[model samples]
Target: MNPAPSHVASRRDKLLILLTVCLAAVLLPLALSGGAVATPAIGRDLGGSPASLTWVTNAYMLSFGSLLMAAGALADQFGRKRLFVIGLGGFIVSSFAISLAPSVFWLDILRAIQGIVSAASLAAGSAALAQEFDGHARTRAFSMLGTSFGIGLAFGPLMAGTLIEYFGWRSLFITTGAIAAVAFMFGVPRMRESRDPNAAGLDYPGTVTFSATLVLFTTAIIQAPESGWGSPLIVGLLAASVVTLVAFIMVETRARRPMLDLSLFKYVRFIGVQILPLGTCYSYILLVVMLPLRLIGAEGMSEMDSGLLMIALSAPMLVVPIAVASLTRWASPGVLSGLGFLIAAAGLYWLSLVDFSASKTALLMPMLIIGIGTGMPWGLMDGLSVSVVPNDRAGMASGIFGTTRVAGEGTGLAIGTAILAALANTSLAHRVPEGGPELSARVAEAAQRLTNGDIAAAAAALPEVSRHALSLSYADAFVGLLHVLIVITLLSAFATFAFLSRTRTQGDGFERDEKGVEAVTRA
Candidate 1:
């Protein structure tokens, strides 16, 4: 054991961490900007009604959210390093398949495959951090991981927009595939086995039931506007969703190794900790994704211009890592989360009253303000969620937290769409009076066209007066979305206040050293 080759030893110790960060970074652009840029191209080549393009993103999200918990459990049972490598490989293959897809159906299949692989990578990345680092190294390791998430998120839109403009939308997948392939190769050899040999096996039955429940619920929400909430499909889907979800709960309670631990919620703080991620992540996706479309499609701005405007959304989070790391020391997590929510709500309220006809400058101010508010609590919420759980259950705690975040994001998108759809319908209907039956019918058709994602057709088919009126309706609908956002933010604030428990600023009695470094002691 004289001198273990210094370079090899150092490389072995750090290879897993480096690969994990790279794996996590690949997920962001795929999840964030791929759909926004690909929608038009996918719809055109595939020949589905323009409205079907929404499914491009919906398909990925549905599978991703549904399988997240099971994937987490799998990573903990098997080895994270092993699973991460496999996941990266699958993602690369699926991405290439999607790039070559001849139809929307094939593309959708590839997208679902991509979702499953991406979910596994995300789950394994968390456990890999725990396995690779100890003491203060773990703290710094996690911070680096968070930094990866932030940078990947910020870079996504810009990268996607440039690729789409210069080459084509498929470049999005090709690029992600290449990066993920590199990560897998670098990760396989040096990555050590870290899974607990004594850990319980996978819960297959619970996984199936829970996955079904999520798929059903998400499908109902997404189809409600299109199929009518009162339709049998919608009603049956919701009913089935509830029954399956309850069954999942029962199965988890009895499973030897449950994907989600039912007992974790008993800690009041555990429940409260879920709110911050839910609110912030939900608003972040809804606003950032929707704003680009609104600015480019509706406001007549170029894609580059719209992308530039949206980049400001990440500005608040840019300086937030240190602030979040420090804020937990000054007050309880509950108070900090509550303050963050209140600030977010205020920003949303300002957004709700936006003068749509005014300059874009007015809009950027609120967006930046909201970004600031949203960024403040990301880390503390994460800290609190994991802080309440035992060390052995770290993987489980992360699973539950990720599930809630996904659920919240799905719910937000559905709610935003429903509110906007209703406003658009009502506004259009009111302006075109039924007294002029023919004109009224034409106006209604135009409104329907707009909802179906056929903007050009809608404008061409409408009368001059009705064209002006429909624009007003679109404006009104955007306002409605802002109001809904404000209400949700306030609700999140109240929930954080009510549920999050007070914790000592130093976090679980782990004091900082004389140099002011807080060691990552076991929870």
Candidate 2:
């Protein structure tokens, strides 16, 4: 073949940057969901108590979500390319170390490290694309990036199940490490370095306060089910989180160059765009986190079978981004996002009607509807978040967007899990009222086992009569939780509709003056 023209070569290089960064982004969620499917096998091999296994997921989410904004600021102040390379290197090392872990302790520690570094890679990679691409190219780039994320989420379970069934659970980490290493090799050589020239010094107090607040808040939520919500420890953590959050706000308002410019909140459209991801992820992604466990434990499906069923939930995301991107020419982003959330809320309502006895086939239609609805706004929200801000602060905007996304996801998981645990325990107690302390203890143990995706072990721990009752309770609890989540999602959809509907179609601008920030006239 003839060598490509210089212009063509330049285009290819830009595309290569997108390709490499997207690949790196895929690794985080792939690793997350992959671990979800393989949790049973991992617990069995690692021999951890049920509570210990929960940390495998919680640790990663807590670390990843909390550090996102700080990482974004660091990338903007330093160099994006440099941060991206370092993050990738750290992720690769953590993955490898996790694969070689001798115990659950090491695995959890390494997973937390993976989450921390993944934040750096995600923020820098997103900022890099936003800075490099513009106009329609920016739209297309974000759309493709959203598709890549959807693909990873959609296929992660299947890949994890297959790996666990044949090669063992360790292979999941090994595979992730290998992929990150390849991305690193490609990215370090061709990636163009960029940073904000006017970026100010790091806001140390703000970073500490913000990160500490998230950590404390997320920890309390994750542990609320085990330690009663009103327990001293939970209350203490909640109080600390509130105090730290206030400190963060005060620090940001005073800092010469705040880690997150509070002035961004003045743009109504920016606030709406940020809320879009949080609402969408809360309604849609939480299902992605819980459905696999439901299938394997309550529904008595194999890991591979559960993974296949999850395709019903994830498959629509693969194509919906491109479809929505095209639809934007006719409809405003607000209309599309609002309509999408309404559709997703409807899907959740439909799912709430499904009985515990419903088969995987029965779930297909509702799951597909939810997937389509959620996917519509996925890429649009991401693009709007960066577009509304100055290009120079793309890194910070990207970080904030990512922080909301992961934080929303983590919060949803915590809330959903808590509701499930509460309802299940209540149902179980009612069913076995006269069974005595021993049986109640066994039932509690079985519930924990089920949450960890060990259906067989949970069943074996109970009498046949108790087992049947337990399954019924689980089903009832799941249906009840769905009802509660549906209400929350509907309210969020309405709020999204209200705010987004008010936004101007043409882009808006921001101007910083000596004393105050001004919103430029919309074009």
Candidate 3:
């Protein structure tokens, strides 16, 4: 037989490299999104406070989100394949361990470990993938990784719901672990080792400061409803987060080899690329977690029903490749991304107008619209992350972009949960007429339980209030939340367009040569 063309062999190797990372990508969302679908069920099985139940999801995100930049730096300092093996090894162990957690507290701890390991896996895998591809081939590769990620989000809920209903919630983790293990077996041998040659050492000071900032910020958000936003603890947390964030910036600026190059912010288009993930955090990620809780908790939908509804919201991701191809052909990325954000904003507005009493199907159209809009940017953001930076700093690009996306998700989810709970508490405030401090505390606790879909517990706490009344209060708060989300989405759309419209061939001040060497260029 005739030997295969040289290009064909090269293409096959690239595909194999991509498949490994794509597998790694899918696990992040599956654990986050699919794990979210199991929250209510998990809560029912292992009774805990609403905050604890939220932590079931939040713990994984917080740990994963906070460590991503450090993980990226490690991948660069070490070898990508080496980090990949260590991370996956730990991840596999944590997944099975989390399945056996006897209480919410233990589950939270194990999930946090799972998240940390996942961060290492994702950042290493992504940076490695970027190293292997160049030019348009790289764009297509990242797009495919994005699509695999979308697949995990789009189907996670449905799979979790079905698994929880029949096999129990533990089955979700077991299944994810088994699938991830299989991917590890198939892909590891094929993945060539890669790393950033210019990596100076791990930026310990920068990593510590950055990690502290997120922990403090997320803590403040989660504690605001209970401690009161003005409480000293919450005030202290917010203040400390700001201080550490400033410290991180100062450290990065002074360091010879910063984990994030502060100079990149000078480029208008690079700033816009960073904003893309921030937009999705509010527009898409928050919705994926919030909508399911609302469906099951407020509307009393079954696990299966909520899962099907989420499909409408996330299913548009299935067409992300087609959407990217068509939209990019007809318009510049600025137009495509900006238009997508506006579409999502419109969907949020339409959702706000929807009556709670309307059929679940009433949510389908707007949810689908929101998904389509956000899906437009989903595939492009990953490409833009590395494209804007120099070829050598691909590791930093992966770290910074991944941090923004994951950290933003963790931060947004905390804020969304707090705001929604506060709104519910406010709605219930009038109902607690003639109450003292003790009663007020009870009301606050009940409000949290109600938002988490634990109506049975909330009703017990407020025996005088009917379950229907509690549901109505939760629904009222949800509508108000939607209005807030709409405003955020619109502002994001305007900012995306304004910043991205000014893109240069190199978003920053670097140009690539035939061998992927980078040199400084004036903008």
lDDT of 2: 0.77
| lDDT digits (tens) for residues 1-523 of candidate 3 | 5567777877776777788779778888889987788888888899987888888888889999988888877888799889988888788889899889999989988998999999999878877787888999887787788788878898888887888778998998998888778878877877788877877768899888988998899878887776777889999999999999999999999999887778766555667788888888888998899888777766778777788889988989889646675656556676677888999999988888887567878989999999998887776676677766676666466667778888888988998899888999998887767788888887888888877877888888788678888888888888888888888888888987887653433344454563323233223
Candidate 1 runs further than 4 Å off: 1-4, 7-9, 12-20, 44-47, 356-358, 389-395, 433-454, 460-467, 505-523
- Highest-lDDT candidate: 3
- Candidate 3 TM-score over all chains jointly: 0.91
**TM-score for each of the candidates:** 0.88, 0.89, 0.91
Most TM-score-accurate candidate: 3
Q: Candidate 3: which stretches are off by over 4 Å?
A: 1-17, 131-139, 386-398, 504-523
* Local accuracy by lDDT, each model: 0.69, 0.77, 0.81
C-alpha RMSD by candidate, in order: 5.3, 3.6, 3.8
**TM-score of predicted structure 1:** 0.88
For residue 216, give model 3's deviation from the true position in Å.
Answer: 1.2
Give the CA lDDT, 0 to 100, for residue 444 in model 2.
66
- Error in Å for residue 473 of model 1: 1.4
For residues 330-389, what per-residue lDDT tens digits would candidate 2 score against the true structure?
877777888888888889888888774665688888888898888887757877777665
lDDT of 1 by residue, 1-523 (tens): 6566986787575866565555565465445555664565455456553234555666676677777777777787888877877777788898888778888777777887888888888777777777777898788777777777776666666776677667777777888888777776676566666786776767888878888887787777766655667889999999999999899999989877677888877656667778787788555667766665566555656555666677777656667646766766667777777777788778777877887557877777777777777876775766666776555555577778888876666556555655566666677777754657566555555544454344555576565545556667777877777787777788888888776645543235333452222222212
